[model samples]
Target chain A: MTEDKFKHEEDLFCSGHRACPGCGAALTSKLVTEATGPQTILSMPTGCMEVTTTPYPESAWGISWIHNIFENSAAVAGGIETAYRSFDKRNKEGYMNHEDVNFVVLAGDGATFDIGIRSLSGMMERGHDVLYICYDNEAYMNTGIQRSSSTPIGAATTTSPAGKESFGEDVHKKDMPSIAAAHGLEYVATASVAYPEDFKKKVEKALEIEGPKYIQIFAPCPRGWRHESKNSIEIARLVVETGLYPIFEMENGKITNVKKLKDRKPVEEYLKVQGRFKHLFEKEGGEEVLEELQKIADSNAEKIGIDKE
Target chain B: MTEDPYEDLKISKGAVVKPRTTLVNKTGSWRSEKPIIDHEKCIACGNCEKFCPDMAVKETEEGKFEIDLEYCKGCGICAEECPVKAIIMEEEEK
Candidate 1:
């Protein structure tokens, strides 16, 4: 590996915010802000990222940011992007050059998949020049690990704890990328903090495109996921390698690229490492539970074509 | 930031905080273990700076890496992801 690959830009998501020790979402925001640069304006909703970074008089962001409500960050961003486009139009009419500005929405799964999907859909359908990034930790991490629509099956969250009658989350994760692609967005991708280079590249690519773009990052939370702090990045990688999370892109409603798994690991390998899924290993009918999860990974691998030959 | 936060201001429509003022907070106190990089074995790949959730690891002008104790949360991610295993997390002393 060359040293050039490791070199990065200034931290737009500055330090001194109060994120938990090994927060994958924090790094996800940091890498995203770095890629977007200082010219960008951010609209963040109520989530772990908002709560951790902005506390009263201090904010970790170096760029201009706005915190609206839990369900309207995308709408706010769309409004701001629309305002910037108006400026572009008037400036062109007057033969003036105005500095380019990008409007981005940094939201979490609860806001994106459940509460704010309507607003997000409106933003995308309106074709606003906004890059909406959803940091999916698979649950409502900010509000004591509640379950959201994006929560994967067989994973225990506070609201979806594994028990005799329940097998953690009963429903499968929402296919958010496909939903975004259905809006005919120019770019839609699913990335992970485990692959930093790809994440940054996708952010840059999404910004370069003029229309609306959606990129959901698989951010792991050590606090909510019940994993070792140091294993945050490791578990993020396992999600991609296990085929539980497929990293792919859709351009103009066509699948452009998929990060094919070299040798896809079993769901057991990923589930065994986290405390949330520990019940799957020790509970009654555990093997059946695992089989259900394995089917999810298999179907994902087939649908996304991660096993390309 | 105003040392007397409430003393200086009129009630305005917006809240004003200077950029990067969070640097004033010495977050290093949050660390139970500190990272000490073995410069002799360091390859300067910059992974520590890149992967640090807190952005505490920085490259000095001398082309050397330094972890800003003021902001390093002692997460030990740098040590964990170090390609060359140059960084070791050492227990902090009272």
Candidate 2:
């Protein structure tokens, strides 16, 4: 067995918060907090994590945390970073060094891909030393699982339900990592909660850099995705193994590293496990939809040069 | 005593409250399934201790893994990751 790589000194994200059983977002938040450590201040937006973990008079956070509106976590984090920097300039001989502090914005897919994209883009453009992490659970799970732009094609969401005429969501998942890389950020990566070691390494690497960094972590939702709670990690791993989600890192708008799948599984293996895709199997003309999804995965594999012999 | 809810907001540093204050809320009742550790068959691999998202699994002084039921959400990641199959998830007794 591999050595325990994710061991940390503190449980920065403490238990007793009301995250659902087998919540990938909660787990990812914990892993991220552990990697960043106590010197960090987190700016969270309104979402499942924000609502669940932070009820009044009770908070799961062990570090300094601020909750912003749904669409302004990045902007708020930028403001906080500026405040710290301004204070540092005024107090040169002070006991604290502002450079030692880390500013982070943790938001969901709805905030990142849709509502808060403008502020996030602005933060990156202004070159704030903040790490913006989007825990992409696909749809808007907090707001009753509505279809967000990050929701993959053919997934049945509340807003885009499968009917006699429609076969679930029509649009594809947004290429958020590439979009972040396009902003010319110093660091951008995609990770999954299943791969804790890789996720931790990316978090640590993002903190070392001095500019804006974006990391979109694939956090599977058990309730939204309609999967057994125990199968969250299995589904997370399957998405990567089947080439549906490419785990890679970018530096200065260039792909610096890619985790290539040695033996790729068919996309069916992943789609078959989720309840959102159960309709795709039970309905007529569902195989065609599955083929189209496979094409998307295959194209991704080709684009990342993972399909090369 | 009905204290002002926004009293902390008046502070200079934007309300730096005490950390880990959530410890007051015991979430043990939230569990529908509970993880039972088989001590005799345990190898103390620490896989269960490491993968627990809640940090409810602890290593005792004797190096055996034990789950603190007060906080364990019973996600079963430990049972799934246990290399020795020493941990089992059973339905919580009502």
Candidate 3:
């Protein structure tokens, strides 16, 4: 039922950037910017994005972009929307008559879930007309793959390095969409770069809504995940097929629909694909870890109503 | 009859806050490590204390923030919020 109504254009993200090969965050950024078109104001935080795209005098962003402190992106974006309104009122009749630009916040998982959560939560609660998208590459990939609250259990990061006495991240990935939905917001959805049509459509839908909207985008981090660039889409597909990252949307705190894969892939197939989970398979009795992960995935699927075909 | 939405806020009703005990330390127990202030790199910006969920970090002599491990969740919010990246989450081996 997937329609190709998407017209892949070239206005926002210019090619030949310094992002690592097969970086999902980069691809998602490109797609998101394109969806919003050139009339967009981006509030980016200090992470892999701010580092890779902008190097001192030169910048990569074509839109009017502001790089705020790591944890204050939502607050900054909210401020930008207000400022735009005031400017348009005094000069061009209130952000309505002129080119209707989208005010968007782009943040990593570290910023969205860990450091900048309060600002994001507050902005969303206040009903700011901004699209808050989280380009989740799992951990804090910008600072060498340190473990953030978004990192899944058994995943290795610089801080949660697998040692003789440790099992990498000890906690499960925090349910961010559920937390966002609990705010009684208009929209909350999950998308991945692997599925561009769905992702683009979701972005479009989010823009059409009046109130605050949130999208937790699953972007693959090749450097942090230790995977080849070509395997990005395949690995992302496995994440959905294994039921780890169920693609679904929540409206008014209730899930309406979920994307179900016809073929259910084993959790091992997903596990062995990423190097971050390499520790889970590199040891004896690794099957136990795999089973535990599968159980978690199954539970998630049940919660989201993702039935196996 | 219209009801107030937050009148039934469960979290603010003096509910007992419990630690994550059911999370079995399959990776062995985490050592209670706290943030040590270098003072040299500390900017006294209060970002660490401002963003700390547990409020375990506090500023002491010379305006440097020190971590109180008792309530610290090892969440590393301080490290992430530190503008200069001064705070590092060091693991204390049990």
- lDDT (Cα, 0-100) at B82 in candidate 2: 83
Q: Which residue pairs overlap in candidate 3's backbone?
A: A88-A94, A89-A94
Q: Model 3, range A1-309, lDDT digits (tens) per residue?
A: 133111111225533245564567766777787678778888888888777666554455667777889889999988877777677778855355323878899999999999999999999988888899999988988778899999998888999987786767878889999889888888999987767778888888888887779999888887798876546666777898888899998888888878986666779898897888888888765566678889988888778778765
Candidate 2 share of real interface contacts: 0.46
- Model 2 CA deviation exceeding 4 Å by range: A1-10, A92-95, B1-17
Residues B1-94, candidate 1, lDDT per residue (tens digit)? 6498778778856765665656556688999999999999999999888788988888887898988887888988899899999999999999
**DockQ (Cα-based) per candidate?**
0.34, 0.35, 0.01
Q: Estimate, for each residue in A254-309, the C-alpha lDDT of model 2 and write its tens digit.
A: 88888887898999999999999988899998888899999999998988866536
The local distance difference test score of each candidate is 0.87, 0.87, 0.74
* Docking quality level of the chain pair in candidate 3: incorrect
So what's the TM-score on candidate 1? 0.91
Model 3 chain B worst lDDT run, 10 consecutive residues: B19-28
Docking class of 1: acceptable
Local accuracy of candidate 1 as per-residue lDDT tens digits, A1-309:
225221222457877788899899999989988799888889999999988888879888888899889999999999987776677777646422223676799999999999999999999999888999999999998889999999888889989998888879888888999999999998999999988999999999999998899999998899898998888888888988999998988899888999997799998888888999998899888888799989989998988899857
Candidates 1 and 2 compared: the better one by lDDT is 1
